[model samples]
Target: MDVTFGFLLLFVATFLVAGLVKGVTGMGLPTVAVGMLGSAVSPVTAAAMLVIPSLVTNVWQLLNGPSLGALLRRLWPMMLAILLGTVASTALLVEGDSRWSGMALGGALVAYAAYALLSPSTSVPGRWERPLAPLVGLVTGVLTGATGVFTLPAVPWLQSLRLPRDVLVQALGLAFTVSTVALALGLGRLGEFRLGQLGWSTAGIVPALVGMALGQAVRSRISQQRFRQFFLAFLILLGLELAIRALL
Candidate 1:
């Protein structure tokens, strides 16, 4: 939109920091960036800027791991529901007023922050997966369509699948990749997906990869324990600000 060098710098730095978080903790790229950037830009703009970087990083995440065929076969039902819900809901979101989408994004941030702060390791029997996953996908898709954030029940539900840790991480990447692509299609249909934004989004990938390298190098020294809690607190504050901004 504005296309200022200063804003581009801010964008790069934000992704650098966000990518560091993802490298260290296996997530938070979009959440951290969107939460902070949303303070300066509209939620929709933040989402737009996130499009390509999100897609690329998540694709790397998905492909770097093994057993893609199995994860896809097993997870297809929920994934399909996610795509369906995204298409159905995002068309409305893209065409209607944006304030509601802004407010939705803010609320998603707040809810995610609070959940990360409070939730403990949880478990559900595998028996529940079939019945529960589609519901989770539907809700996650609707939220992603409206707000461009997609954690909440999806992450927890994935965890509940009792997948190995590596596979779980890859699963997240796969799901997020699907979400980002589906979102891009919706944005394109709405005529909000511009080539310039994609260019900037592509440029952001470099800083993100650099940050990922830095994070991996320093992972042993960083106290990932406290880092997460602090991140959640920061997000809570930012999310509140966004929600307030949306209301006003």
Candidate 2:
């Protein structure tokens, strides 16, 4: 594909916005980018585009935060679950119809948002927390690989746990890393990964990193509640887009 100046310009602007979200929140990179670009490109391409940028920004998060050992120990089960889900879903990619897929994705997001708003329980049960985290990882991995959507079914569960803010951010960064890696591998195997595609995708990280630098400065000023509200609102918009696309 010719690298149109139009696509490049859109890519730069979208990456900057996505980067700001990731820079501050540590996990919304793909979400924000995909949501914006999904309208302009096929979702598959959008998913592939994220691979390079996500890898770049996530490396920054891991370096700045440096909790790999702890995160690995804590999230291994979830990682494995995600891997399994990705493997199982690989075959479905070719047959996957985006409109129907969008419906499924939209339903999951809507349900998640509702749960986040209305769940009676504030935290996972002690017994469930250990097992459930990975289960969330599994769902997130499947959705991410199949649709380039990272509506991790488990994020709300994690949020409800209310770990220290930094730990939560570290955990999210790790989750993004795992999902992004799996999606890249699966897409590569399926031949959706390409050098030219990646070249453009790589350009997105510049804005993402800029967002991160600015995010650090703002993180301390924003209350967690405000961040949560903003994230939920974003999810709702994404979900609505998917749902409406499905209907159309």
Candidate 3:
């Protein structure tokens, strides 16, 4: 794709908004960026663009949290499963029909948002976590390979673990960081990710970081519950638009 001025503007704007969402909520950067950009670019291209920014932000999120050693010890199975699942689905990364991918992306967003809105208090038992973690990771990896979004069962499953707030945030960062690297590897293997796109993807870091800072500032002053409700509602609208466009 040509690096037209308008495209650059849109790219920056998209990441800025996406970064803000992640800053406030501890996740959603890739989902929001890819969902918005998928309308204008192919899902493959959008996923490629998100590779660097997502990696950087998520790595930061991962490192800043508590007990990295413990988290990895407990979550390694799931992380490995995510990698294997992504590798298994690498072909889908390049061969997917854009329309179908769009619908898939939209469906993912809608499902995640709806679950967050309606689900009552829930928890995954300790024994169940041992058995269920890999399953969730594998499903999340396949979905990430196909749609460039990694928040479906992964996020919900994480929430159900009932970690403390900070630990949960760190866990999300670790999962997303793994997913981003796995997706990048899949894209690289298929030759869909190219050097030319790096310039734009790299440039996105500035806006994304700026947006995160602003969002963190706002997060301190506002009701997170209210903001989250608003965010989910916006996601529903965006998801519906993407789905409708795909069907048309």
Candidate 4:
């Protein structure tokens, strides 16, 4: 099979698994999928595959999550920061050296994973949290635009909140939705959203939905603590994987 076709298959499989993780735990779509796919293809392709599916999947989340009024009140500071940071980061995207961008992002994920496991609170604490929250959005935006690895800082911050399963899931879903739309626009401006690319990217929606459907059916069977533990472990391993791939 051609390398391109192989990568397309990889995208479907990656997001299918990502969708399962998202449906079961309410997050991890970009984290798991991008971590794996970024290793196999140009980060651009990995990100492109996610565009359509993420947009579709997050619509459900936006509707199902906490009320818009409540989420806006609670998360506005973080959201505004996200907008500014995404714009800045996307503007600086260097199509020239994405490998280095990948390396930087891979390292950031590793650092975040280490902190989460070692911190007593499993949280970043108060003052540090608010400032860093926006920075997280900034960093993730840069990586998302440059290397298609868009989970780093945001995931850790969100996870640190230690919200109830549903709240956390909804928050992640909403956040992902916002970020994905910004990215889609950025990619379009860069001429990265051609018809053929959009078509294949859109194709992943089927598997994404299917995986989420299957995950929802089984979500109740899984233990929350067990899922959290696995989630942390997955981040650690994924961080390591990206680092290793970049180094090699």
Clashes of 1: 0
The residue pairs in collision within model 4 are: none
Q: Which candidate achieves the best lDDT against the true structure?
A: 3
Tens digit per residue, CA lDDT, model 3, 82-157: 8878867867768866577668767877876777678645578888998989999999888777767776667778
- Model 1 agreement with the true structure over 85-106: per-residue lDDT tens digits: 7766775555556566656656
The candidate, 3 or 4, that scores higher on TM-score is: 3
Candidate 4: count of backbone clashes, pairs at least 3 residues apart or interchain: 0
Please list the C-alpha lDDT of all candidates, in the order they appear. Answer: 0.73, 0.73, 0.79, 0.70
State the lDDT of candidate 4 residue by residue for 180-218, as single tens digits.
887777777777667876887788889888888777666
Q: In candidate 1, which residue pairs clash?
A: none
Which candidate, 2 or 4, would have the higher TM-score against the true structure?
2
In order of appearance, the predictions have TM-scores of: 0.79, 0.87, 0.87, 0.82
Residue 138, candidate 2: Cα error in Å is: 2.5
Q: Comparing candidate 2 with candidate 4, which one achieves the higher lDDT?
A: 2
Candidate 4 weakest ten by summed lDDT:
87-96
**Alpha carbon RMSD to native, model 1:** 3.6
Task: Give me the runs in candidate 1 sitting further than 4 Å from their true place.
Answer: 95-121, 216-248
